[model samples]
Target: MKKLFRKILKYGLYTLLALFISLNLFVILSGRFYLYKGIANTYLVGESGPTIYDLDVFAYSTLEKGQGEDLILAQNYNKQKLSAADRAFMESMETKAFLVFKGDSLIHEEYWDTHDKSTVSNSFSVAKTVVALLISIAVEEGKITSIDEPVATYIPEFKNGGREIITIRHLLSMSSGLDWEESGKNPLSDNAESYYGSDLYGLVTRQKLITQPGETFNYQSGNSQLLGFILEKATGKSVTKYAEEKLWKKIGASHDAYWSLDKEGGAEKAFCCMYATARDYARIGQLILNKGKHKGEQIFPMWFYHEMISPSALNTADGIKNSRYGLHIWTYMAKSGQVNYCRGIKGQYIITVPGEDLLIVRLGSEREANITLDPARKGDKNYIESVRNKVGHASCLFHYLRMARTLTK
Candidate 1:
């Protein structure tokens, strides 16, 4: 009986070890090393998953400050406050920073969980707009002659496949028609590859065209990263360096921004991962609000800004027109006005209300489970309730705009 018990224990231990080895082998063979990283940085560290503060995982290139004047946004802390319910909602959403600028003056500013005015967090997909801005700047300077130019013009390897027909306009409008389905939870997803895998160029250029370019609006991070590569190819400068020379210097940013890389001296993860304070982000908001002008200096072309803000007339799966996205920017109709904004995956928003001259920046880790950060969590409810004609935009966003209007008047 003693020998039998001992044998049983030994076999149980062996079986567990074998299973663990098999899991590791499967992960390694599947090109999903990010799973290992995800576990180590998340579950092992007592986190549910990656948070905004996980920027240290990768090396970064700094957008070194040039001659940025202090941002024109005058700071007027505590001039107003959100309603208690709104504040509770923001707090529950794990807000790190909430800032509101009415015209040129900051009316309300608050922070939570040790995050301050200077706390730099991951910008996630908000960097997409930055990419758009860079593309326009390149165009304005004749570095990129036309948005209608074939992507193959810069990346020669794309010339053979159906990818050759994909234009910069398609990418900007999220209508590239690439065979990429973004999913953060799926270790095997294209987003996982772009976010965690080492070869951005190989991952992006190799995608097969599944749908005809410019026929529909299917949001894919690969589109933005591919544009990043094109920006590099056209401007003859790294994305970070070009942004420094054009955007940061022109806007007079108050903080040094960092763009995470796939590896040392590698491509900037331009689909996401720009890190900067919320205050600096509002500087960008003011640029959009002012239509390419930064306190009197024209930072970007006004026509380009208009083009960037105009929504692409692409059909959704249901054949409804896509009103949510513009050329790398996003829009939703708020009761106050149309809200054009840059968004990151984990609730990072740099919003501009053009009609009211309001700029709001909200940065945090969680948006809401109902809004589906993981894509798999997307619900059956397709459209959000709205005061105007339904835009079919993010339902979660309505709260922010409502709160902004409710701020002490």
Candidate 2:
């Protein structure tokens, strides 16, 4: 017994040591040590995709500078009353990046420790909003006829099974009724395996529908992936290319954005894995805020813009209560007014408040409690819902603006 115990203890120590060495090697090889240098240089040259850094430049170039812009430079609010603890909380959040703009001018910008204006933080599901934007542009350009059209009209393979009934509108609202498990930590779950698996698109598309299309509002990443496939089929070009020609270039994005391709490279994962600086992401929010217009150009049909942000048909008062989803964006009722946001897993957000002419972008590493809830007690089948309520990207920015409003009053 003593010999066995000794052997087990020795092996455990060896395993722990090996894990430490492997992690350090991964950090080094992945260029995490040189992340800041690489990101700053790369993003400035327009390499990173869909991030706050990119949006900052877009906002500054477009909006008129004012007292809010000065607050951005001060790194502390002069007019707004923010407690020391609140400021510290914002700074301490892991790898956080944020930017606020009012009618094209930057009012506030922050990048926490080890984070800078140029870091290409992952937008996660916030990429879905970009996908929606592209789809809208495609429709405006006559590449796509209407949202009511069956997805099978573009992707013929979807004609069979429940997919035939699915529409672009269904996919946008996450009401396609696809049986997707989006829990990230569960290895057996579809979303978790897809993220780490070799064939993400395949895994997602293979899923069968659990409910009839547009009958229920189930958040599913597979819906976004399917949109990418459809977009590619309709345009005969990659989603990234379409975005560059119709949206990014037209919007005057200062940085190049990147979308992660699947193993087959036939489709970009429109659900997640877009990389851009903070400012660039804000540009997207601003575009939506402006009803898909840049300068004098109508980037997308104004009707399509209204539909994308309008409440979905599938959502119920009890189902979403305080929050409503439209297309790929999340809508919230703020203290000041109604707000809509494009949110991503691990706390990435791009918020647009049309009433206030406000746009806010936030990107960050996974927050401990933001993504998932604690595991249920053993044998308790009722899974405890996550405590992290989805907060709109506009929430913080609105708070600051409200403060500014009060001060002026």
Candidate 3:
């Protein structure tokens, strides 16, 4: 009996070793090395995927502040009260921060789960808005011709493979039609490579044009990363430096923000991964409220600012209007009027009610998964079933908007 048990153990060990060898070999040959890193960072760590708290997990470039400090302070800071129900909602969501800013002052601020006002968490895809802003700055400076220019002019790899027709405008509108899965769940998807793999340029350039550009709205991280590469080529500096010199310093941000790179001295993860405090993130709303002005100086050109908020004439392949996502910033028109917001995957939001000068910032660990079309408000001309925007608003947005309106009133 002892000999038979030893024989079973020996065979099992040999089988496990062989399986491990085959897995590593396949990972190398397929160039899916990110799969191994993903496993180590996620499954082995007892987490499902990357969280907003992962700033130190990767290398980053510091976005330095200029020689100034214009703090955001209000007499009513933390004076605004939250109802028990609203507080419970935030607490149950594991929210790190929730702040409401009225013009240049913070009216309400709250943090949970050991987070404070100075906590700098990952800003996920909210950084996409930052990339869009940087591109606008490049155009304003004439570093590039215009948003209409073909991407091939910046990245030579885009010159072929049906990618030549794709213009900067298409990418800004999330209509690049690049063949990217954009799924974080799939270990082999392009999203995994973008987040974990080292070669950002190669992964993006290798993508094939799956459809004609500017026809339909499709969200993909690759489009944002491509814009990052173009921004670097056009302005002759890294996105972090350009942002620091141009927007970050001008916005009066107190805490330093970091943009994660694929590696040290590598490309910025322009699709997402900007680490910043909630107060600093709220300044984006003030910049918008002032019509792209900081300290009374125009930070973005009026034409470009208009483009950022204007409704796109594009639609989903299913024939639904895609107005909410315009020039990389999300918009919603409700009874409280139009609100523009930048959203991250983990429920980080910098929402601005442009008409009322109200800005709401929320950072947290979860977001609504089933985002569906909301009922049309006062100014929705195309509110019929035929043109109802099924992708306009997430349910959580409405909750936050309601709370903001209630508190402000």
* Local distance difference test values of all predictions, in order: 0.83, 0.66, 0.85
Error of 3 at 74 (Å): 3.1
Mind giving the per-residue lDDT tens digits that candidate 1 earns over 272-375?
99999888898889889999897688887888888888888888664456777789998775455777999887889998888988888999987753222223
| Number of the predicted model whose lDDT against the real structure is largest | 3
Best-performing candidate as measured by TM-score: 3
Residue 216, model 1, lDDT: 93
Model 3 regions more than 4 Å off: 1-19, 68-72, 373-392
Check candidate 3 and list the clashing pairs: none
- Residue-level lDDT of model 2, residues 59-132, one tens digit each, is 11111111111112333333344357656655554437767666777666667777776566667888898888
Give candidate 2's TM-score. Answer: 0.73
Q: Poorest 10 consecutive residues of model 3 by lDDT? A: 383-392
Q: Please give the lDDT score at residue 296 for candidate 1.
A: 83
Better candidate by lDDT, 1 or 2: 1
